[model samples]
Target: MRIVFLLCSFLSLFFASELITPLPLHINYDKSKAILGKKLFFDPVLSKDNTISCAHCHNLQEGGDDGLEVSVGIDGKLGSINAPTVLNSVYNIAQFWDGRAKNLQAQAIEPIHNPVEMGIEDTKALLKKLKNNGYEKLFFEVYTDGLSLKNLVDAIAEFEKALITPNSRFDRYLKGESILSQEELSGYELFKSIGCISCHNGILLGGNFYQKVGIYEPYYADENLGRFSVTKLEEDKYYFKVPTLRNISKTAPYLHHGKVTSLKDTIQIMAYHQLGRELETLERDLIYKFLLTLDGDIPEILNEK
Candidate 1:
């Protein structure tokens, strides 16, 4: 009887709709590389002015974003797009809102030299600087190429890859360790019924594919070209990579430009603009509760800082 019950539980998950999937309990990554990368991630030496680090924009404490409408970077320059959360970014099909960089390594390289970001002018000079700054032994031990750009980014990417935050309320429910409250369960049903699951599905909820933000209505934001900047295809215009909802509650000022600050308002906007499903006030509240279930504990690295 016990074997039959356990097998039935396993089979239920397999037969269920693929609209939602639970995140793994934890991520697996190299400890040495992740540690090296963590130091580099928090080090502002990678910045031109020695004032900005990746954590400045993507602070792990604040849902992996700096909690600003748009991120302020090196030399106190403001960037055009909102800094997406680093938490669960490994699940994203591509990095960045534009999906320009193929992987995290490529994505990691750009911000170092981005004029509006870290503002590092020369790569070779930066590499030389890091080595001279007593990082030679660290890089050499972790990577065969020593302090090369590839090794630097790889170490950083390893750390980024380990940024997944699992074991949220919804994840616990999915794993059958806990149960959702009545309100949360209602919200979950509404979420599936309202077609939100169409795009926001899978392990990360919404990062697996690209979708136009305003399918039912036109989305107006300032100079936000999205994927068109990468592909230069007309159809690709306004198509941006949907961000993961794993830690959505803490990642405020939502969207590409960080235009929507309030979670409640953002929900209504997404429904009207993307799904064309006008939500009742109570319905919106329920959905909001469900979104809160997605919130997970912050990364341990952030707690140390």
Candidate 2:
């Protein structure tokens, strides 16, 4: 057992020189605020009709998404784009498909007043309702301000910050604590050699930067000419913030539009569209298995709650 352990450790160190790094086991987050945020996240009171919460779209139990192509908002109002997983979302450069919101705190409040989403007729009324529901004390307990928009977004953002799923199988492999089969390792090598790592690098593996969605060819999505609407720059058209693949297997249907449902198909389409190369059947299979290793445990607050 000791010899086996040492060999595994050596291999981990040997293979740890990849582009992507492992997520830390713990993240710094405000616990009391996060707890309040958890309640807010799960509570359906945020919507105008009392039907939708933030969790309505990003269901933590279902890989932080509601298993829909485009998440519906209050009163069956359809949102234009796919709802990205909230898990590890704090790692993103910006929020939303067009990168509209700059941070999670900013992102949390948009839906509340949006005509489609939470659809609150009045923000003040929502606060008043929360206060009436005795959330004032809860908010005061966390942020002396209590139940205000600032405190609400802050608390919710704190919970999101703690949503990191550390120590995936690939992360264990990176840390030299676990072994990858030859097929998995081969797929990983292909992942590196084929240039997937350029955008899909760093701890969150693809959230750090924006890239053209279809470098080799034009890609049409449900978005309004991709990021161009945000920047109003013609050059920015067709560009998208590359999404994290941290829990890729769970957070499907894939892409900004949720167009592809199958992991194999997404991989193949990406290889051809982004890399301009079609992966062989064996290569796609191996890579798919490797991507599966990204699935890991959710945050402790989610489990404990």
User: All candidates' lDDT scores?
Assistant: 0.84, 0.83
Estimate the TM-score of every prediction: 0.92, 0.92
- Total backbone collisions for each predicted model: 0, 1
* Predicted candidate 2 versus true structure: per-residue lDDT over 1-305, tens digit per residue: 33553354345444546658888899888889899899999888988989999998998876888788888999899988788899989889999877889999999889888889899888899899998888998887878666798989998999999898887899999988757888888888777667666657778778776677777766776545778888999878887888888889888888888888998999898888877788999999988888988887777788755
Best of the candidates, lDDT: 1
Worst 10 residues of 1 by lDDT: 1-10
For candidate 2, what is the lDDT?
0.83
Predictions: Cα RMSD each: 6.7, 7.2
lDDT of 1 by residue, 90-178 (tens): 87899999888889999999999999899998999999889888899999898887888898899888888888787799988887865
Report the Cα lDDT for residue 203, model 1. 93
Model 2, poorest ten-residue lDDT window?
A: 1-10
TM-score of 1: 0.92
